[model samples]
Target: MDVVIAPDEQIGEIVADDIAALIAARPDAVLGLATGSSPLRIYDAVAERVARKQLSLARARGFMLDEYVGLPPGHPCRYSTVIDEDFVSRVDFAPGAVRGPDGDAADLTAACTDYEESIGEAGGVDLQILGIGTDGHIAFNEPGSSLASRTRVKTLTAQTRADNARFFGGDIDAVPRHCVTQGLGTIMDARRIVLVATGDAKAEAIAHLVEGPVSARWPATVLQHHRRVTVLVDDAAASRLELADYYRHAHAHRHLVS
Candidate 1:
C-alpha cells in the first residue's frame, strides 16, 4: 500500500493522471467506478483531459461498484444513472460500455452472480476507485460485511441510509434500504485499487483503514492485503494517521528508493 498526502485539489489531478496513463498503456483497460462526492473531483479532472484530447475512454469499459435496490429506472439517484450523468456521459465510452449490478432483477441473487461473471469475462477490473463511508463502509458493504464476500445483496444500515439521505432530499425514508454491491473479496481481485478520501469527516475511517487491523468492522481495511493499492488523501483526511510524517517523507522520496 502507498499512502499519498496532498491537498484536496492535487489529489484529483494525481489520480486522473494515473488513470490517463493507464488508458494510454491499454486503451481497453477496464475501470471500476465509484460514485459519491469523493470521486467527483477526479472525474472532473479526467473529463478535462478528455476534452483537451489528451485522453480517451472510447474503448475503455467500466463497472460501477454498487447500485441501490428498488429505485425506479432512470432515477437520478440510481447508481447507473448517476454514473452516466457524472462521468460516462462526459467521455466517449461506447453504448453499453459501462455496467452495474441489476438492482431490480426479479432474482437479485442471480443478478449478482451474473454481474460477477460479467466482470470476469471483461478481463476483470484493471483499476478500481473507492470511497470510504463516514461509518467505514465501502460500497454498500457496511460494517460487519464478510471480508471474503462476493457480489451480493445487502441491507443498508440505518447509519448508511442517514448518510445517503442528502441525495434523497434529506429524507432518510426516501433512501433505499437495500443495495447490490461488490464484496470485499470481489474488490480485492482488481489488479489495482485507488481509494480517495477528503475532509475531517473521513479522518477516522482513513486512519482505521490505513493503520488498524484487517477486520470486517472496517471493510476498507481489507485493502491492506491487496498487492497493488494506492490511498490518496488530503491533509484533513490524513490527520488521524499516526505515521503521517513517514507517509509524507516516503511519498516525497519514493522515486529515489524505489
Candidate 2:
C-alpha cells in the first residue's frame, strides 16, 4: 500500500484529478465512489475536468459505497440523491452510469444481490474510493464485522448516528438506523482502492490502518493486505502516526523517481 500526505485540499484535488485522468484514458473505468465531506474536493476537481472536456465518464460505471435503508428514494439523505447532488449530476457521466443502493427496494436483500451481481457483470471495480469513519469503520462495516461479509443490511451505531445527525438538521432521531452496504469481500474484489481521510478526529483510525495489525475491528486496516491500495491524508489526519514524516517523504521521493 502507498501513503500520500498532501499539503492541503488543493494537493488532494491534484491527486484526485490524476485519478480522473487515469479513468478517462481507460474508457471502461468502473469506480466505487464514496459519499461524505472527505471526497467533496476530489469530486469537484473531477467535475471541473469533465466540464472542460478533459475527462469523459462515458462507458464508465459508478458505484456508491452505502445507502440509508429506510429512506425514500428521493430523500435528501439517500445515497443516490446525495451522490447525484454532489458528484454524478455535476459530471458528464451517462444518464444511467451510476448505481447505488435502492432505498425503496421492496426486497432489500434481492436489491443487494442485484447490486452485487451488477458489479460482477461489469468486471468489478477498477478503483474504490473510501472514507474512514471516526470510529474506524468503512462503509458501515462497523467494529467486529466479519471480514468476509457480503452485501447486506447493517444497523448504525450510536456514534455513527450522532456523527451524521448534523446532516439531518441535528435531529438524531431522524437518522435512519439501518443501511445497505457492499460486503468486505465485495470491496476487496476491487483491483485498486484509495481511502481518503481528513481532520484530527481521524488520526487514531488512520494510525491504526497504517501501522496496526490486521483486524476486522478496524475494517480499513484490511487495505494492508491488498496489493494496490493508497491511503491519502492531510496533515491533521496523519497526526497520530509516529512515522508521519516518513510516509510524507516516501511519497515525495517515489513521485520524484517516477
Candidate 3:
C-alpha cells in the first residue's frame, strides 16, 4: 500500500503520470474507471494528456465500476453515458472499447455473470481508478457486503442514495435504489488500484480504509488486502489518519528509495 497526501488538485496529474507510464508499456491496458465527483480530476488530467498528444487511449479498454439499474438509454445520469461524456469522448479510445454491466437487462443476474466474464476475457484490469463513498462504500458495495462477493445487483443504502441525489437534481427519489456493481472480489482481481478522495466529508472513510482493520462494515477497507493499492488524498480527507506525517515523509523521500 502506498499513501500520498497532497493538494486535491495536484493529485490528478500525479495519478496521470502513472497511467501514462502504464499506457506506454501496454497500449491495450485495461483501465477500471469510476464515476462521480471524486475521480473527475483524474479523468480531466488524462484527457488533457490525450489532447496534448502526450498520451492516448486509442488502443486501450475500459470498464466502469457500477451502473444504476433501469436507467433509460441516453439518460444523462446513466453510467455508460456519463463515462462517454466524461472520459471516453475526451480521449481517443476506440468506439466500443469501454463497457459496463447491463443495468437494464431483463435478467440482471445473468448480466452480472456476463460482466464478470467480459472482464476476464479482457485479461483483467491493469489499473483501477476508484472513489470512496462517504459511508466507506466502494463501487456500491455498501456496508455488510460480502468480502468475497462477485459482480451483482445491490440495493442502494439510504446514505448512498442521499449522497447521489445531487446528481439527480437533488432529489433522492430521482436516484435509482438499485445498481449493478463490481464486487470486492471482482475489484481485487485488478493488478493495481488507485483510490482518490477529498474534502472533510471523506475524512472518516479514508481513515478507516487506510488505518482501520479490514471489515465488511467498511467495504473500502478490503483494499488493505490488495497487493498493489495506492491511496491519494488531500489534507482535509486525510485529516483523520493517525500516521499522516509518516505517510507524507515516506512519499517525500520515495524517490530516494525508488
Candidate 4:
C-alpha cells in the first residue's frame, strides 16, 4: 500500500497526473471509475487536461465500479448517466466506450455475469479509481461481504443509504436499498488501484483502510492484498492514521522509489 497524504484540493490532480501519463503511454488503457463526491475533482482535472489538449481519452474505455438497481434509464442519479455527465461528457472518449452494470436488468444474475465477462474481454482494468465510504465499504460491498465475491447485487446497508441520501434530495427514504457493485475480489484484479478520500467523516475509515488488518468487516481492507494500490487522502481523512508522519515522509522522499 502506498499512502500519499495531500491537500484536499490537490489529491485529484495527483491522481489525474498519473492517469494522464497512463493515457499518454497507452491511449486505450481501461479505467475503473468510481462515483460520488470524492472523485469530482479528479474528473475536473482530467477534463481540463483534455480541454487544454494535454490529454485525451478518445480511445480509452471505462467501466464504472457500481450502479444503483432499479433506477430508471436516464435517471440523473444512475451511475451510467452520472459517469456521462461527470467525466465522459467532458472528454473525447469514443461513443459506447464506457459501460456500467445493467442495474435495471430483469435477470440481474445474468447481468452480473456478463459484466464480469466484459471486463475480462477488455483485458481487465489497467487502473481502478475508487472511493471509501464513511463506513469503510468500497463499491457498495458492505460489511460482511465475502472476501472472494465477484460482481453481484447487494442490499445496501442502512448506513450506506443514509450516507447517500444527500444525492436524492436529502431524503434517505428515496435512496435505493439495493445496488449492483464490483466485489472486492473483482477490484483486486485491476493491475493498479488508486483510492481517494477526504473530510473528517472519512478519517476512521481511511485509517482502517491504510493501517488496519485485512478483514471482511472493512471491505476496502481487501485491497491490502492487491499488488499495486495507491491511497490518496487529505489531512482530515488521514488524521486517524497511526503512521501519518511516516507516510508523509515517504511521500516526500518518493523520488527515491524506483
What candidate 1 gets wrong by more than 4 Å, as runs, is 256-258
Residues 161-187, candidate 2, lDDT per residue (tens digit)? Answer: 999999999999999999999888888
RMSD of each predicted structure: 1.1, 1.5, 0.9, 0.9
Report the C-alpha lDDT of model 1 over 1-258, residue by residue, as the tens digit: 999999999988999999998999999999999999999999999999999999999999999999999987899899999999999999889999999999999999999999999999999999999999988888889999999999999999998999899999999999998999999999999999999999999999999999999988888999999999999999999999999999999998898534
TM-score of 3: 0.98
* Number of the candidate with higher lDDT, 3 or 4: 3
lDDT of predicted model 4: 0.93
Please provide TM-scores, in order, for all candidate models, with all chains considered together. 0.98, 0.96, 0.98, 0.98
In candidate 4, stretches whose alpha carbon ends up further than 4 angstroms from where it belongs are 255-258
Weakest ten-residue segment in model 3 by summed lDDT: 249-258
How does each model score on lDDT?
A: 0.95, 0.86, 0.96, 0.93
lDDT of 3 by residue, 156-256 (tens): 99999999999999999899999999999999999999999999999999999999999999999999999999999999999999999999999988875
Query: What would you estimate as the lDDT of candidate 3?
Result: 0.96
By lDDT, rank the candidates, best first.
3, 1, 4, 2
For model 3, how many clashes?
A: 0
User: Which candidate number maximizes lDDT?
Assistant: 3
Which residue pairs overlap in candidate 3's backbone? none
Candidate 2: which stretches are off by over 4 Å? 255-258
